[model samples]
Target: MTRRVYFDHSATTPVHPEVVEEMCRFLKDNFGNPTSLHYFGQKARKAVEEAREKVAAAIGANPAEIVFTSGGTEADNMAIHGVAYTNRNRGNHIITSAVEHHAVLNTVKALGKQGFTVTILPVDQYGMVSVEDVAAAITDKTILITIMHANNEVGTIMPIAEIGRLARERGILFHTDAVQSFGKIPVNVDELNVDLLTISGHKIYGPKGIGALYIRKGTRWRQTLFHGGAQERLRRAGTENTPGIIGLGKAAELAMANMEQEAAYLTRLRDRLIREVTEKISHVRLTGHPTKRLPNHASFCFEFIEGESMLLSLDLQGIAASSGSACTSGSLEPSHVLLAMGIPHEVAHGSIRITLGRDNTEEDIDYFLEVMPPIVERLRAMSPLDQETEFALSDRCNGCRVSHTCRV
Candidate 1:
């Protein structure tokens, strides 16, 4: 059997064994509704609170500030839309980056339809957004600024701390989609100066369908998508996914214990892959900030070939990689994140993202490096519209006809 190698950690990670063990115990032995007032309910409630505390400690936030949600998308939607609706009287303007995840971008777009004004700031060639641009976009009516902690597709880490400081000075609320950076990088809400942050469990090797949002104390917000009996401080309304929450807590604990070692290992593997691809492939361009990016993320674009083709070829070789965000994969359109970074349409369509994780090894990377060049070459040859040759198709046809003078 062919060995399957997964390089799409940015999309989601497999639940760790410890997380699964913790969750199974809660699911089977500790089954009870957290909202129930009976003994069974009390046991479940204790589990939820313990999980909450674990999540809070992971990010240096208080347990009271963490509001559990179904996942990162829900958390992001709640933070962005909640802020917009609740603070409408203060302002109708919201600022964000062009490269945010669809969760943030789509929510802001929906807000725009309902009389809210949105300003989308652009990034540079290296995929880094300028704090100055964010500051300049702010107005008296600007109620909130939402930027991603790190770009999902390109792995660019935004200067959230700098932007947070600016937002705080202006009394504008700040939120970040930290799904990509939270477990991979060390994050402290106080250190970043952010008003709110979003995290997804599956992205951090926890179970899917569980996530959390950190809302700073004193930030008043209305719940836009819930109806229940005062659970989650009335901010979020739903029966807690006790098993999933327990898994998340275990995952968070494990991450905190081994964050440094995991980072160092993944960084070494990521750098080696980058070096291998760049050296072996011609006309390939690396995306994102060279150094200030995720330890596990390595993104690049091979000019003149469609990203989808490259991804499929890798998949055939038993390697799973991504052409863009997992959310936008099946669509024909190029990645909005790549377009926002000012990459040309053709180049953006040629982009590929390879994210590493704890499960990867040096041998896996070496095997990928060995197989990648031939795949790129084969795809480039098969492409009818390759731009490598300077002459037009007609010019090349003329030469072919001359070489085979009377063949026809």
Candidate 2:
């Protein structure tokens, strides 16, 4: 029997049992509409407010500054659209990087079509967005600078603090999507120097339907997504998702309690996987910044195979992983993050993102290392490039300067 291992934590995680219990209580015994004004309603409302405080405290934010939304997508939409709409008269330009998740990339692109000019800045080979480029791109018309806290695909932690400081000096608003970094790393809004931030619950072992957008006190932002009830301080309007909120609150508390030890454990496992894989596999490029990346993230691009093929093979072996961002799965195009990092199209297609979690173990790393080489060799053997470079498949090297010398 193949041992099942999940290495796609960047996509989502299994809900924590403690979070489930807290949510179940809200779902079964304490069920009520937060706005009903009855005892039941008050009970539900109290839970929601407590969740707001937990989420806010997890990131060193004020409880009043947190507004719950459906998920990161909605939070990102709120942050970008809200700021852009409120400040449209102030400026009509936005700045972002090429490597942001589609939720952000597409959001900014949508704004670009609505008469708001946008500057999509380039990134370095490590997928790090240059702060100097951000400074250079700024103009009087730039209203919002939205960059992610980390690259979801490559795991490259951006210099968000520097960029945030620059935005502050220019008196422009800055927002960072902290969906990936919220629970995995230490995320303090003041330390990052951002006016707004976004986080999702599911990414932190909580329920899926809940997320939050942090609007720093006195940030020139306005509600632009919905119009209805007075929920969420008139920032978002709807019947509160009471159970999901409670689950997220519990998850946040647990994360705050155990973050340091878990981060250190995953870092060791991640380093071992990274070092051994590169040592064993030839014709591979380690994606992302080597030193300053996410502790549990290890991404790579093999020379002569499609990432989807590797994924299928791994799945059959009861190992789960991702070709790139799970949101972009099944797309034939290469990862935008890898391409932005100056990796060739062919190389980018071979991208694989392995994000570890608390559930993973050192034994999981051992099994992965034991199996990965033969898997790569098999895929490479089947690739035409491995036989000889002539008529190589899309996974073939497209003038990549490497040691793949065999030619038919």
Candidate 3:
């Protein structure tokens, strides 16, 4: 049997054993509605508050500021739409990057249909958003600026602190979807100076269907996304996902304790993957920032082949990987992130994203290196794109803007 390896940690991670263990007690023993005033209810409520504190401490936030939601999408919507409606009288404009996850892009697009003006800032060839563009996009009517902390598809970390400072100076509320960066890197709400931030549980080795939005205590925001009994301090309305919340809290605790050490380990493996894959494969280009990217993320585009084909071939070899954001993978179109970074449509169609996690080892990377080169070569041979001649003449490399550094 082929050894199965998972290299799609950016899409989601397996729930940690400790997180599962921490949540089991809530499902069986403390199964009571947190809103009820009974003894069991009080016990559940206490557990919920404790979990809030754990998540808060992980991101330098106060417990009152943590509003639990179903997942990152809902948290993102709540932050953007909540602020849009709450502060409509103050402004009707939003500023965000062109490379944001669909969650932010779609939410802001929906707002645009409702009479709000939006400024979608462009990114450099390396997928880094320009802080100057952000500053220039802001206007007196710009009420919010929502950019991702680290891009899901390419793993480029944004200059969020600088952008946040600009937003602060301009008196604009700032929000960031930290789903990809929360556990993988250090994210302090104070240091980023963000007015609101979103985090998903599954991205951090916790249960799915659980996430949180951190709204600075004095930030002008309202909970208009849902209307129901006053749960989440009247911010999000639904019976709390008690078990998932417990799991998320446990995951956050574990991340806070081991993040630094784990980052170093993942970075080494990630760089090794990058070096081996680029050196072994021909007509390949690394996407995203070469260095200012996530420690665990390695992305590339191989010419003369499509991403879906490479993904399918890798799967048969018992490796789970991705062509782009899992949320957008169903689409046949090329990645918006790669396109935004000025990669041609043909090149962007061949992109692959390999994100590492705590469970990965050097042996796993070695296994991948052993299998990946042949796969790309096989695909290139079968392709009608005429790799040898076309690849030499096409100037696609020079057009990609990374040709000077790309090993190919």
Tell me the TM-score of each prediction against the true structure.
Answer: 0.94, 0.95, 0.96
TM match of model 1 to true structure? 0.94
lDDT per residue for candidate 2 within 1-408, as digits (tens), equals 889999999899999999999999998999999988999999999999999999999999999999999999999999999999999999999999999999999999999999999999998878888999999999999999999998889888999999999999999999999999989899999999999999999988998989999999998888887899998888899989999889889999999999999999999999999888877887776888888888889999887889999999888888899988989897999998888887778868888999999999999999888888889999988886444344332323332224544132
Q: Give the backbone clash total of model 3.
A: 0
**What are the clash counts of all predictions, listed in order?**
0, 0, 0
Best by TM-score: 3
Q: Model 3 over residues 1-408: C-alpha lDDT tens digits? A: 999999999999999999999999999999999999999999999999999999999999999999999999999999999999999999899999999999999999999999999999999878889999998888889999999999999899999999999999999999999999999899999999899999999999999999999999899999987788999888899999999999999999999999999999999999999888877777777888888899999999888789999999999999999998999999999999988887778878899999999999999999999999899988977987654343343333532332443322
Alpha-carbon deviation at 190 in model 2, angstroms: 0.8
User: Which residue runs does candidate 2 get wrong by more than 4 Å?
Assistant: 386-408
Which candidate number would show the highest lDDT if scored against the true structure?
3
> Model 3 — which ten-residue stretch has the worst lDDT?
399-408
Model 1 per-residue lDDT tens digits across residues 188-242: 9999999999999999999999999999999957888777768899998878889
The residue ranges of model 3 lying beyond 4 angstroms of the native Cα positions read: 388-408
Cα error of candidate 2 at position 3, Å: 1.2
Query: Model 1 off-target regions past 4 Å?
Result: 389-408
Residue 230 CA error for candidate 3 (Å)?
Answer: 0.7
Global CA lDDT of candidate 1, please? 0.87
lDDT of each: 0.87, 0.89, 0.91
